[model samples]
Target: MLIDASSVAASADEIRAGAVSGIIFDMDGTIIDSMPSHAQSWVAFVQNHGIDIDVPDLMRRTTGRTGAECMRELFARDMSDEEAWQHIAEKEQLYRELFAPIFTEVAGFKAFAAQTRARGLKVGVGTAGDRHNIAFAFGHLKLPTPPDAVAGGDEGLAGKPEPAIFLEVARRMAVPPERCIVFEDAPFGIEAARRAGMRAVAICTSHDAAQLAGPHVLAAARNYHELIESKFLERLHVEPA
Candidate 1:
């Protein structure tokens, strides 16, 4: 059944007692501190291409979107399809270089993921990024395995607020949408979870907690530690590792 916020809040106690089986995580803002790196790369790419848009403006249009989708918005009417693709690829390559050294697991995220896996709950990734970004997330984080399944932009899934990527992750994990939970930092990602018929927890790794507020979000935490300590997972009925 679709549980409301208060019901979900109360259910955390039940979850601690034992209800959910899997988690779907968004890679960039939710799992790692990579959004700024992405923004910088985007600004440089647009500037180099002689396009003119600022960071805040870009953030609105770009955050939670695949590089290709962002390229479409920025280049759609202005450039040829091939040129748009090329620009997006070039921008992402630059992002990889910039993000390589700085890419590190979000606070408490690695431990939380290990804990979730140890409890036998499935893990899956849903991101609007490309394969290269996926590689960076796993490689940089040193995860033993690429998440059991991943939905990326190149896979042709619709982007955030569309529900396709999260739905795909649910399918790959063999979990029903209603029984799964999503962790995200974007408003769009939260909406995507709701659209997919899943509950979500928002993290304030990028945006402020107030900005990410929504009915679909069961709780919002500043970091993974806060999430774990606050009984966020336990409430979901996720067992201790």
Candidate 2:
């Protein structure tokens, strides 16, 4: 169901002519190149608990899921709320420690964000990462401006492929689902955006363009630099502030 880049480019006029008014970004892989650290943390966490798992397989299954959801899936057992939270906290703490020194934004993301804001478009972040990870990103990245809305997994929203997180972010941004575009790095996230009735651009950071392809994906790019160079954002027809 994946369309080619040319087709997406051909839809530029339609996108610019009122089809999109907001942009929602997924945090870990899409906004920042921290998935390696995340994967390592997951491997370390599972091994520490004496569980054996293939890191890549585990990552694919849990990429867009909440920590609690991931634990249940990983262990194949139901857990009390308190136990789930404890494990999530521990795992995320390890992830932070591993990623702290090397944290970096995806190439050209900051500039693109600034341009989007200058065009007066609503901007939001929707992520399966918890509040602590969110705080870590804000502290390290030092974004030029805070997002208009942020919907995180710790907020008790259903995770990706369910549409709840993206839907909530759109709501908080005061934009309708059909009028927004989502940037994502995972298949589940792409599905979530489509289920929320929005267009999506795949960020091929953690996965290749082929792996990220799907019917709802408008385009695929390695970073914002490519998106800009290819006129992807120009297709949105945002005017200068």
Winning candidate number (TM-score): 2
Per-candidate Cα lDDT values, in order, are 0.78, 0.86
lDDT of 1 by residue, 1-241 (tens): 1222443344544444325667899998889888888888878887888987776786776677766678878765666546766777899898888889887677889988987787778899999988888887787788765588799977877788889999999899888887788999888888899999887877877876566766666777767887666656555565322
- Candidate 1 is scored at a TM of 0.88
Worst 10 residues of 2 by lDDT: 1-10
The CA lDDT at 104 in model 1 is: 68
User: Which residue pairs collide in model 1, if any?
Assistant: 12-235, 15-237
- Give the Cα error of residue 95 in candidate 1, in Å: 0.9
Clashing pairs in 2: none
Worst ten-residue run, lDDT, model 1? 1-10
Error of 1 at 7 (Å): 12
TM-score of each: 0.88, 0.93
